[model samples]
Target: MMKIGIVGATGFVGNRATEVFLAQGHEVRPVVRSASSADRLTIKNLDYQIASAFDQSQLADAFKGCDVVIHSILGSPGLIRGSVEPTYKAAQKAGVRRIIYLSSMIVHRSAPAIGTTEASPLVEKQQFPAHPAKIYAERKLLKLREKGSVEVVIFRPGIVFGPRSRWVSDLASQLSQGTAYFINEGQGICNSVYIDNLIHGIQLGISTPSADGEAFFVGDRERVTWFDFYRPFAEAFGVDPAQIPSLPIPEFHHSRKRELISAVTNSQFVQKFLASVPEDFKQNLKNIVPKRNKSSVAVIPQVEEVKQVEHKPTPVVNEMMAELQQSQYKLPFDKAERILGYEPIVSFDEGCRLSIDWLSQLKQFETILKK
Candidate 1:
């Protein structure tokens, strides 16, 4: 069995990678920064290496004699570019044989092409702030492969969803509450991948010789529109999909502007003044001009029952979840399957069920605590 070391194994993606490797009977070492985080992986029987990504001495020691190193580090655009070069240098010096890097689809695709696999020259010219830094990280890994013996594989996954995932949790929370909005009639398409599928891609990256020195996109096979995507979520919540309204872009923008102004002014009187204005002022203004399509009316709450459950959730979390519940996020899985043998183990419906089950359990636990 190969001896593998994982940097950033405490993170969401890294945790899944650890589970995959351990299940495959590989000896795994997880590099972590704290003992508490390392303790959480006890179930995997992984060896622990306490070291920060920037500490080359600690990293070199952690990487020594490992057959493969999975670098799953998360950082801002600047840090991603700056930190990767040194990690590659340390991995080579420590005699690591292979490396797997996780990057986002945004690195290679333009905003408009996000949910589509069809490549456009537009993608090449797009200037997303995060793309250049991701490109730099990929280049550093490739440079090492060319100059040194270590093989490198890069996997770029679309927006990730599954149990305990940011997207899934966000959607669940939104459906439970009632305050999610869609952008521009919610027409924007999105590509998403389940965490299990992403882990499958990573497993192939480590085991497949064809994956060496290459970059691949990982996502679901089916493409979905926003309305269709959220229909199931609303059904799962036992609510009518038609009850969810699409907010006009102008009104949404105006609401956000008022919130920003309130924060900046820091005067309770100013905040109250903003709040007292009709919540639909922007919508009313758009109606007077009659430009573009008549914006859909905001779905008023029909029953007091749903409102109570919605109000119980934290507002920020509820809003994010609502947006996810009403948004379309899917991915192109065919290429990942053909090249990396990747397949999503969890379907979108299955993900929703899992989230609902967790919410049920959480409620039960709360009820027990009150006694």
Candidate 2:
């Protein structure tokens, strides 16, 4: 039943690896780049393909006749180093047999040392600026898998979190806009990995045949931290990881507006400065910026009681939330359980009870307590 082909099929790990490779029956296709990102794949009659993940002939015409193509592309580090050698030369011009690439135990920077793994020696100087673009897209797909043509497996995974994760709906939208935090006291080591245990190590890197050109790491068979990964989203928002507050781990500067948006996002001048802006002059520069102060001195329509401010993140979200709360260790997935016989069948208390039951089935705590 193998025919899988998931480029970046609407993200958050290629839309949960196209619903766990079409509920393990296989023959899922998702390659998306448009038609509204394949209309956010909630899965239904999918044989999807649109392409443009840095286009190698539109990803070899969306990886035709695939037998495996999971690049799992996410973006920017100039679209993950311009879509890793045009997705391995479009999975060797569509004759793909193996390509599972996801990669990111943050190329070993968000704290390692205390015996790292996956043959340690990565961190080419990082403060998690996307860890040297996932170590230049895993040394450009292990040097295009040393040119033995296709077949490359490379699942790094860690801190992938669960339930339509931006690490659990951006920490349940920063605990409903109180702008959540914790750098040191949350006590590091959250090398998490429950997005169905990273699609169960991408189905053991698609039935492990000596896991092809190997490079595992996968995560979360415990030793969890960062307050045991924010204690079930702070007990699903009653909030109290000791009144969440720490911050000492930061040290980044040099921002000529982040070096002019990282030199206009590795330029074509940020697409001609967003196509020479207009849309009502970008909605009149968002109504001339002052978020609240049209003061000609007006009276109050009083009933004040909504406070939870202390918010302090930006400096690139506090160096990626204090570099994943300064990890310090726990990234061992025992070489993905001795070469792809992987494990982690979900349990960090049952992946926070299915990530707080997918945030109460998407009411997302009643839409973040009605903002």
Candidate 3:
């Protein structure tokens, strides 16, 4: 059994990876930011290290005895270089053989052309916010791969949904609140990869020689639609998809005036100034607006003019979401299939069955419902 060092071991993906590897009899060294976080793991007699991905010293310490290391830290674009670069340098120092970096299908646009592969260009200018960071990390690590010190394998998965995912938990909240709805009647296909299926892909990456220096895209074999995906969850939650209102496909509008004002107001220079404003003073401005009727208050002329131009929709999507919902992005994993011989063992249906079982027992559902 190989000795594995898992960075970000307590996270949704990292914890699951830890469980699967440990169950297979591999020696798992769970690297976390604190000792208490390691308590999340059930297996005893395993090594644990208190280390942050941001700290090179701690990372080197944790990675010293590992044969392989998985970089699964989730963070913003700015945080990617700081975390991933140090891990690479440390792994080199520690004599680690291979490193697995978790990326996502989101590196591409929502509606990529059919048969898109790992070599496809990233959504370089896309405003998804996280895309740039993921792409940046992949490039940085692949550069390290060229150095020949450590073999790097990049695995990208799509719409990862299961328990502990925002997709499930947030949808649960929306269902309970009667606010769950689809953009464009939910006709688009969801390129969903179950959590277990992703773990299966990770397993293949660990042993498959062909996977090194190559990227793989993984997904469920089943062709499930957005409607099909949500319907089951809605029914399990005792909610009806038909009964939930659908919002119109929103037009893309990023108001420069509003953005500028928001940026200025939220800036450090203005934070204290805004906080110092009297609550009574703010209330009096609203109260001072002439009450034309019980339900009607006079809007300032400038405000009324601005509102006419704002054109905000009931909100199914911003431009980005609309772009996604309008088309199908079926990510073909033929390359992963051919090279690594990775096939999704847990079919999407069976995977969902397991997920529903977990959802029933998750404290996340309880906490969300309480909220």
Candidate 4:
């Protein structure tokens, strides 16, 4: 049995990875922050170690005996330097044979270019929170090939959706107010990677010798539209897909202006400057421009009647979203298929059926948690 060490082993993706490795009769060890985190795990044939990825000593210790270390921790951009870099250092020190990093699709789509591929440029602007962090992490890991013996392989996945995904976890509650809108008026494509399918890709990456020092995107073979993806969840949430209103896709000018203002306002210097602006002047500007509420644009429009949401348009986020329902951001995984023999094992319909079953049970568990 292969000794596999998983960082962030209890999280959504990590939990599934843990199950996959364990069911294969591999000896699984979870690197968790607390001893109690192991209690959340229902599986047997596993052990645990208390160590944060930030602690190189403990991380090294955790990776000591494992044949391979899978770094699957999902955290803020801060962790790129904090944990990701350190974990790589630790794995090297521990003499781990291979490292599989869980990277996102944003590395290729710096600004949502059409037809994303592994060769797509790393996002130049670092627009989103994870974009810069992931690019930085990938650079550091790839640079390791020249310096170390660890096999560094990175696999980028699209927006992962399952029952545990926030998309459907509490969607029933989120849409209970009879307010729902089709995001971007159903213009966006849902680049959804089923959780199981993603795991399958990871397995191929792990075992494939040619995958070392390379990057690949793993996703479903067929493209699924956002409307079809949303409709299933809507039905599960008891909302008629037909009745949901379309969310407004902001014009480029408005979106750009809002993004610039937001980026500027987030800085202390700009905030201080804006803090001195007269309230009346700000109000007059608001009256003239009539800013679009971000919340309304983000969620489905609140039925036939539209109310403004109060948040700013996240342009970087929207860029990641596909502009064309069918063809936008069609991520190509030809490299994965060629190098690793990877293709989606779960079809969209089967994946959705499995997810709905899990969601139904999740609702019951959430009720228990509430009580």
Top-TM-score candidate index: 3
Error of 3 at 247 (Å): 1.8
TM-score of each prediction: 0.70, 0.32, 0.79, 0.76
Q: Which regions in candidate 2 have their CA more than 4 angstroms from the true location?
A: 1-43, 48-64, 71-94, 101-113, 120-150, 162-185, 192-225, 228-238, 243-327, 330-361, 367-370
lDDT of 4 by residue, 296-315 (tens): 44446557766665553222
Q: Encode model 2's per-residue lDDT on 1-371: one tens digit a residue.
A: 88888888788888887887778778888887666557777776687887666668888888889888888876556677777788888888888888888878778777777798888888887644556887888888878878747888888887887777888887877876667778778888888888888888888888888888878888877798888788777867778778777767656787678767775675433533443454456668898987886534454568465454655544234676686787777877877787777888878888877777778767647654322
Off by over 4 Å in 1: 39-45, 109-128, 184-187, 250-334, 363-371
Residue-by-residue lDDT tens digits, candidate 1, 212-304: 887777766556555555666667667676766666433222366775664445333443344235435745776788575454444667654
Whole-model Cα lDDT of every candidate shown, in order? 0.66, 0.77, 0.76, 0.72
Candidate 3: deviation at residue 85, Å?
0.9
Tens digits of lDDT, candidate 3, 130-215: 67668888999988778758889998887788767777776676776666777768878788888888988888898887788988
Question: Which segments of model 3 are wrong by more than 4 Å?
Answer: 39-46, 252-323, 363-371
Rank the models by lDDT, top first: 2, 3, 4, 1
> Which window of ten consecutive residues has the lowest lDDT sum in model 1?
308-317
